[model samples]
Target: MPAASPQPRRPRAGSRRDEAARLAVLHAADDLLVEHGFGALTVEAIARRAGVAKQTIYRWWPSKVEILLDTLIEDSDKRLPVPTERPTAESIRGYLGDFARFLTDDPAGKVLLALIAEAQHDPHTAKSFHTRYLGPRRDQERDMLARAIDAGEVSPRLGLDATIDALVGPIVYCALTGSSIPRDLADTLAEGLLRPRSN
Candidate 1:
């Protein structure tokens, strides 16, 4: 019997080419998000911009919303750093202000608006947003609030869930409304929620 022909080598798992391709796709998606709202985004547009085929996008993301969601998560991950120190009211103010500034900055803010708009119209996108983005953020803030309560910086009288809403609700409101919340206002909002209520 003739010897079997040599098999073609497979690409390495962590090849530089693969990493560059992935980054290109993500960068394309990010740029499109800024140029057009999420509702206007298409997988074809992303693939074309990235210099890849539609199959390449679908192979990684199930839908356009998923692509945008992942892109937003990855981009935000680098820009925002959660505080590691003990959770005090001051720490909460500082962290939230930094996050708010991020949201207001170019590209990131636009992406956030697109995601929120998409979530309003599509249930699957909404679920993905909650699970992939909102859920993790909520959990992280909840832990920080818990630590603040333990530190006596926040009143134990405030319910954990309620406090979470209090900290996040205003931010969401401003983001969706496309309005600015004054710099001093974020600290005040935190104080209003954390301060002890006299019986």
Candidate 2:
């Protein structure tokens, strides 16, 4: 009798994909974005580059934008962490400077701006971007500001939402306009927003 044909390997149980596969997908997405721009990126292409099944990509991400968003978040977390050990004002200032530099200097930053532009026209994209990325980041920043307020570092009268807008709005605006992002912009914003607690 002929030997039994080789059996195809089965996928791992449950929803947890292999870590290597996950990183491959994220890196593939970023590579494709750099090579072809967002308009040309697709799950098929990402799967091809990542050497994973297209279904695997779909199983992990609903869209290329989602993959890109995940990649951006991962890169940012590693490269642009907000300092937690310093004085509140110094921390905020350092974070703002880091954020501005990230936006202006990183490849992922260009993709982020593209996503933001796409979000303006695509409500689903907007919702996903906000729910998955922007919303969480905003919450983190807000908590930081709330702590500063409690400690009397930032003014109590400053609304967290407004404070957030004030802090990040300029960087986003300059990025959108293709204007020069002054290095001192972060310092100016931090100085304007952070104040000592008064008795």
Candidate 1: segments with Cα more than 4 A from true spot = 1-17, 196-199
Deviation (Å) of 144 in candidate 2 = 0.6
Every candidate's lDDT: 0.77, 0.83
lDDT computed for candidate 2: 0.83
Which residue pairs show backbone clashes in model 1? Answer: none
What's the true lDDT of residue 104 in model 1? 77
TM, every model:
0.84, 0.84
Tens-place lDDT per residue, model 1, 1-199, is 9999999999665433366677788888889878876667788999999998787778777887777777788877778756668888788878778777777785765777788777888898889999999888778778887887777776844588887777767876888787886777678777777774334
